[model samples]
Target: MQNRPDLAVGRVRHQLKFRLAQVKRVQPLTPHLVRVTLSGDDLHDFESASFDDHIKVFFPQPGADKPAMPSAGPNGPVFADDQPRPIARDFTPRRYNREAGELDIEFALHEAGPAATWAAQAQVGQYLGIGGPRGSFTIPTGFDWHLLIGDETALPAIARRLEELPPGTRVATLIEVEDPSARIDFATQTDLYAEWRYRSESDFPGGALLLALREMYLPTGEGYVWAAGEATIMRAVRQHLCTERGVDKTRIRAASYWKRGVEAVHESIDD
Candidate 1:
């Protein structure tokens, strides 16, 4: 439990650094979602104030037991020339308790890759490395309502917003899951009206989430929207919001967590 697993702990600066942590516990949220709790003294200063903030999870190489920690370079991350680059993937921070030193990250057991493979078999005392989330996009809370849309991969971020948003904020959620069994409940104080669309019941061309968005009614007044999941569908959703619904581009945030039919970033690294 080194203060800084990959670099010396800073005495003054608070820049994000690589942290070495071990799995303390795991919880199966659903048949296809697992929550892995990573903890260590190195997380005492972990900062993830924004609901949609992400962290880079580093996994052990092919046959290694633990991930190789990267050192902070003058301008970027630096690794040894001979060392195999550990598999890394972006994951949202579901929860972070600095006082108790704990970080919870959820994995969508959808794709087969080093990150998902590691999370699926993660057990107590298993080492993992995390870094960055160097910045946060703290959305303004003045919106009259909020619209959230996504799939299993977006759950971590969706859940975070629900838990942290103002209790009185009105939120409309449209989530598409693998099946009915994948639907989940949340503990939050936001004024939420949620709708679930099962992929098993969806017709292609637009998929469940986009179709749901098409049929549902968005709340009135100035509103904010956040959507994530398959890249293609996300693009369509964003387009619809901008062109069809007239939602201001600045007030909507859409991201592609992964692309359908393509190997995840970890499995198909580009040269």
Candidate 2:
């Protein structure tokens, strides 16, 4: 059989660096989502090859003007012994313009967290620190069809993926949000089927995303499933797709964007 690039997954590693950036603009995209655009000369060489790529964002400590960034060590980031470690969280790179030296990261204000708190009060010209995406996990868009699922925290990645898909691609998105106001318009040229589930309507721990997934009919063809959100919810989604839906494990990608009551949890779910 001929090699199928549509089924191929690519990984790319990037040079790691800690860059200090200033908040260029802060725009509220929805009632629960805010988009913060950061810009600096340090971002001129930044790269993010995947929609789900994450970067470590360091927030300034109370009474501090800028965050205390770690040095890039041989093994990884190294912090000074005397300085207070910066509060950091993994955030998806929503958009990046190398020519303009700007990066857009959307912050979900569903819960009170250091990142969310900082983003809500962010002001133009305020300094923040950002670390590398480190690497990228690029999924092939040439698949016959695609299924994307996630909650509020995964909106940036889901939106990016939808925008990147080429014309004629078939994609279905199941998104969970706090309420109807949280829904936002997505611009895409693909054959799209998008649904929004609301937590206000259901007492389900993670909203009605998984239930909707189970009841919906998937498109016919070889397809890839991508999901990210609360850890437990994502685990169940992955299990359902693999065991009940009969999708190959290799054709599904799931990530835990956050865990209830846990801080700074970002992990891939395999198995």
| Candidate 1 Cα outliers beyond 4 Å, as residue runs | 1-14, 264-271
Tell me the alpha-carbon RMSD of every candidate: 8.1, 1.5
For 1-271, candidate 1 gives per-residue lDDT tens digits of: 1132222211222376899999999999998999999999888889876776778889888777779978878676888889877778889999998877999999999657777787788799988999877767667655778888888989999998898887888999988888888988987898899999887776673487777787888766777888888777788888888889877776687887888777653121111
What candidate 2 gets wrong by more than 4 Å, as runs, is 1-5
- The candidate that achieves the highest lDDT relative to the unseen native structure: 2
Question: Against the correct fold, how does model 1 do in TM-score?
Answer: 0.90
The residue-level lDDT of candidate 2 at 140 comes to 92
Instruction: Write candidate 2's Cα lDDT for 174-203 as tens digits.
Output: 988888999989989999999899887677
lDDT (Cα atoms) of all candidates against the true structure: 0.80, 0.90
**Backbone clashes, candidate 1:** 0
Model 2 C-alpha lDDT versus the unseen true structure: 0.90
lDDT, model 2, position 41: 90
TM-scores for all candidates: the values are: 0.90, 0.97
